[model samples]
Target: MAAVLLTGTGVTWTYVASGGHRFDVADAPDAPVAVVFGAETKTPYLTGRLETTIALVKAGKVRSVLVSGNAAGSSGNETRAMTSYLLTHGVPMAEVVVDPYGVDTYDTCARAVQVYGLRRALLVTQPYHLPRAVSLCRSLGMDADGVNAQCACGGVNLFVNEAREWFATVLALKNAIWHRAPGVASLPH
Candidate 1:
C-alpha cells in the first residue's frame, strides 16, 4: 500500500512537472484564460494570484479570466471579491468567469472543466501551491499550465499552506481516480 501511494505521488509530481515559473509575461504563452485559484479574503497570496491574473489579461498573456474559489455564500465567497477586484482594475465583467463552487483545489480543477467549459488555461497561484494546481487541472484533462504568481507572503500562513499541500497532493491523486464532479459531490453553493 505504501508503495502504491509513493508511485501515485511520483506520477502526480511527474504530471505537474510540465508547468513552471515564468520570470516574466514575455516567457509565457498566450492562453484563452487565466484560472486564478481562490484563497482567503485579502491575503497576500490570494492578492498575488488575482493581481497576476489581472496582469495576464492586461498584458494579453490571456484574453479571459476564471476566478475559481469558494462561492458558498457563507464565509468564502471569494469569486465575487475576485470579480469585483478584476473589474475595478479594468477587466471587463463579461470576460471574467466565476466558479463559486470550488470548495478546494480539487473542486476548482475538476469544476473548471465540468462547469466552466475551459479547454486550456494558465493556472494562477503562488509557487508553493502551483504544482498541485497544475497536476490536478491537467490530470483531469483541462489542457492546463501554471504560472507562479509573485507573492511575498510568509510567516505562519505560508508555512501552513506548504504543509497542507502535502496532504492535498495525495487527495488530488485520489480525486483523479474518483472523477467526482461538484454537481455530484453536492457541496453547498
Candidate 2:
C-alpha cells in the first residue's frame, strides 16, 4: 500500500515538474524544430494544441513541423489530421512531413530522429505524455524538449495517463539498451 502511494505520488510530481512548461514553438530560440504526435480520436486536446503549433510555423517562427502518427481509419488518421490542420492554417504542405507509421510515442520520436534526420526536436503533446516522449528521444540521441498541450479539463485527465507514462519510460529505456527500437519496419522473421 505504501509503495503504491509513493509511486503514484512520484509519477504525479514528475508530470507536474518536468511536464508543466508551456512551450512556445516560435519563441524557443534554441529549438528550431518541432514534432507533434497524433493522438487517438478521443483526444481533442491533442489536435487543438497541434493547431497552435502549426500557427507558429505559419507565422514563420518554427522552421519545420514534423507530424508523426498512424492513420488507421478514415477518422483516426492522426498525421493527416495534423497536416490538414496546418494546411488550413496556411503552413506550406511541403514544410509538414507526415509520418504514418508512428503508432506509439516511442516510435514517433524514434522515427523522427532516425528516419527524418532530426537532431533536436520540441515534442508537442499533453503534459502527462511529455516525460516518456522526451526520454525516448534522448535515448535515441536526439536532444529533445517538450511543450504541453492545453487541456480543457486541465490536470484532471492526467491521473491514469501519468502512471502509464512511468511504465513507458522504463520500457523505452530498456528497449533502447536491449532490443530493436520502435521506429524501424522489420524485414520480417
Candidate 3:
C-alpha cells in the first residue's frame, strides 16, 4: 500500500512538473484562446475563472475564451452560467465559445484539442488545479500554459479541493498515458 501510494504520488508530481511554469495573468504568454474549466455556478470558483479570463483578454494575452463545462451536471448548466458570467463581466459574446460536453478536467482538455481545434491555449483555473489542467492539455498535443485564478475559498472547502488533487493527479496521469478520449459524445463541429 505504501509503495503504491508513493508511486502514485511520484507519478502525479512528475505530471505536474512536466507542465513547466505556471504564470500569473500579467506574465502569461499570448495564446489564441483562454480555456476556462467549469466550476459551480455563482461560486467564487466560477467567478475567479471568468475574472482571470477577462484579465487575459484585456491584457491581450488571448483573443477568445472557450468556456467548457457539463450542461447536464449537478452544477446546473455550467457552460451557460460561465458564458453569462463572462459576457456580463465585459468579455464580448463574439469572443466566447462554449463546449457543453466538458464533463471533467480530462474531457475539457480533450475537447479543447479534438473539437475546438486548439493548437495552443491558456488554461484558467484555480491555483490547485492549474498544474493538472496544464499537464492534461499538453498531453493532448496542445501547447498549454496556465494562469492561476484567484478564489476566496478557504476552510473545509479549500481543504477538500486540495486533498482531492492528489487523487485527481493520479487519474490525470492515467488519462494522459492511455490517451483516453472524453467519456461524453462530442457534438459535431
RMSD of each: 3.1, 4.5, 2.7
Q: In model 1, which regions exceed 4 Å deviation?
A: 1-24, 73-75, 183-189
Per-residue error (Å), model 2, residue 186: 11
What TM-score, computed on C-alpha atoms, does each candidate reach? 0.85, 0.76, 0.91
Q: Candidate 3 regions off by >4 Å?
A: 2-19, 185-189
Error of 2 at 71 (Å): 1.4
Who wins the TM-score comparison? 3
Rate residue 136 of model 1 by lDDT.
Answer: 77
Ranking by lDDT: 3, 1, 2
lDDT of 2 at 112: 85
Query: Candidate 3 residues 1-189, lDDT tens each?
Result: 975795577456745565565899888889999999998888898899988898899899999999999888765889999998888889889999999999899999999999889998999999888888888888889998989998988999889998787678877878888988787845433
Could you give candidate 1's per-residue lDDT for residues 38-142 as a string of tens digits?
888777887898888887887888988888887664455688888988998899988988787776888888888877788898989887787778877777888
Of the candidates numbered 1 and 3, which has the greater lDDT value?
3
lDDT of each: 0.78, 0.68, 0.86
